[model samples]
Target: MTRYEPAVDLNAITALDVHVHVESDDHGHFALDEELLDASAAYFKGSENRTPSVQDLARRYRDAGMAAVVFTVDATTATGHPAISSEEIAQAAAEHADVLIPFGSVDPHQGAAAVQRARHLVQEYGVRGFKFHPSLQAFSPDDPAFQPLWAALEELGVPALFHTGQNGIGAGLPGGRGIKLRYSNPLLLDDVAADFPGLTVILAHPSVPWQAEAISMATHKANVYIDLSGWRPKYFPPELVRAAGGLLRRKVLFGSDYPLIAPERWLADFDDLGIDTAHRPGILKQNAAHVLGLR
Candidate 1:
């Protein structure tokens, strides 16, 4: 199997979408169970194909003059459902290296095995970073049991993008399908940012209900960042817009949360936010490039 290496020409791409999901494998296997999948589709009012393979993502993003960081969350142990293989995703991404950058996921509940797999994905498969969903994975980011995994990632020299705020995965289900929303609170990640100062921590989404906490963390921590994804820019909280245009411009990155929310729709709404022209390039591409070490 060929190892993944990015061949993307930075100048050719208009933006870098930092959060995109590959929900299905080339085979028929899906990343989430049918119930959760249907719930999410309904939650987003999505009529489009919800599950897109890595190749489909590459072509779509390339057609839009953009590049994307693609990944699947391994919530296998937490959900009792198998995940689409990160290894396979990375190998497939290598074939479309010009437009696809792969990020690896490991079920945090697996303890030592998770750390080893993370190392293998980065060293052998060449994943640029990692993705985590604290709620779906049923693990607290600041839990003492997971310190080793955080330490390993810090040593690996890659960022960890954690899904914070609202999640569509188990929305509207009984007890939200046993997924605890409290685990995703951005405040929980503040301890992680403090403990692992060397590790770059990306707080995904605007941290709804806790926007102040998210904004504060990214503002206070040098290694912390926020990605504007999942929600359309037109609906962004006033403070978030203010921060993105001012103090947090260099710390905010672009992400579309594709399939559920298209990049085209996200960008179209972003244009109306009236952020300063000077900060637009950094939010759209430059900041993400710096985080991904593409500079």
Candidate 2:
């Protein structure tokens, strides 16, 4: 099969939403196991079908006059649930080149194969980035076993995003269904960021209980960025709002972990943030454009 690739026309879009998911494929293949899916849905109390085809996502974003970076995480070994096809997402994005950007995810626990997949997704499929969920993927961010995976992506010049806080996947479950929150401790990534300075790292979400650490790390590391997603701005931690709206202004990018947290709801709440309207374009789009190497 031909590998996935997307040719985005940056000029055609108004905002680049950097964190969106293609939760399920058309064939009823889900990105996570059934139990986790159910548990996650319950945590969010979401009644909608979160999983939509990449084509559907393209239409959703296009209608909003926006663009999205879509990817499905591969936790095959960890979750023992086959992941949605990265190649398929990429190919679909290519078809919707007007609005979608494809990211590839690799189960770092897969070691060598993960490195190979990272290469294939970039060199062979044209993925611009990779996503990892240290908690769900069952790997410590600083583990040496996955060094090769980070090395490959770094060498390829693609950014890496890690889900870094209380995860929806296992929330409110009996024992949180064995998903360890400790694995996602944002500080663990401090070592990875230090070791792979060339790798552009994104510490996704609010990183609760460790929000201070997340903010400190992003402030200390030039290559580290934080996407404002997974939580509404009105509910934002006071410190995060201060940093994004003032202190770490350029270091923050807007991302609506769409479906779970719709863009409309996110933007509506974000509208109240005392951020200067003049900087809206930058936070909502230009910052990501700069991070993603677009204009």
Candidate 3:
């Protein structure tokens, strides 16, 4: 059980991708079932390899001159699919510490066990943060039952990255495979940010249909941030584009939701967003550095 630690040189890296996923382990086990994986692949129309290992991610990110925060979702209770071990991911990432930063995930439905696992991941495995998929996990972020989990993350002083808005997983399937989209609404995280002010909350993706709410929450809460993942920048809502260039410049971070949306494609589209040139550096790297405590 090797502990992972980041050795990324902020000056040398062009970007920090804060939302990449480790879809498969070395043994060829996938994080999601075939149905959900197929659904997401169809939705994104992605051509890149979908189930890349930790080593694959490391090679890709290193070749691209970028650093990535990699993780796998632990939706065991909701999806009934076993998750790739975050511990193994962390240990593998330790070998490529220059490019890969591991983030741990735990099934929120596991109650106290989840909280203990989170601490173990951080303290023992050296995970820098955690990833949560409310829609896939089928839990309301504001539910009181998960407060202890949030409190534990806050106590650890690491950020909580939650999937917000529409999810590609289970998309186009009958009843969307019973994954509730309502659970991912960024507004639900408002209660969490308000309650756990010390824990940094990263609302992943654009939060379409609720972009305004996401922007409002990030604007209203000092600890709240938004990651520009899961959507091409050209498709970003006008208000979000404006906010990223102006008031929310320091509150937005770059993320490509890799494997589904390639960083190269995301960056190409981003160039067309007309963001202020002065804000580009901060949006691409500086803001994420601060949010991840790398600064």
Q: lDDT tens digits, residues 1-295, model 1?
A: 8899888888999999999999889899888888998999889777356999998898898899999999999998988898989999999999999999999999999999999999999999999999999999999999999999999999999999999999898899999999998999999999999999999999999899899999999999999999999998998999999999999999999999988899989999999999998898899999999999895
Spell out the clash pairs found in candidate 2: none
Question: Which candidate ranks first by lDDT, i.e. highest?
Answer: 3
lDDT string, candidate 2, 58-101, tens digits: 88999988889899889888878889989888888888876888
Q: Give the better candidate number (1 or 3) by lDDT.
A: 3
Q: What lDDT score is found at residue 183 in candidate 1?
A: 95
Candidates sorted on TM-score, descending: 3, 1, 2
Better of 1 and 2 by lDDT: 1
Model 2, position 46, has a per-residue lDDT of 63
Cα lDDT of model 3 by residue, 146-205, tens digit = 999999999999999999999899899999999999999999999999999999999999
Query: Clash number for model 2?
Result: 0
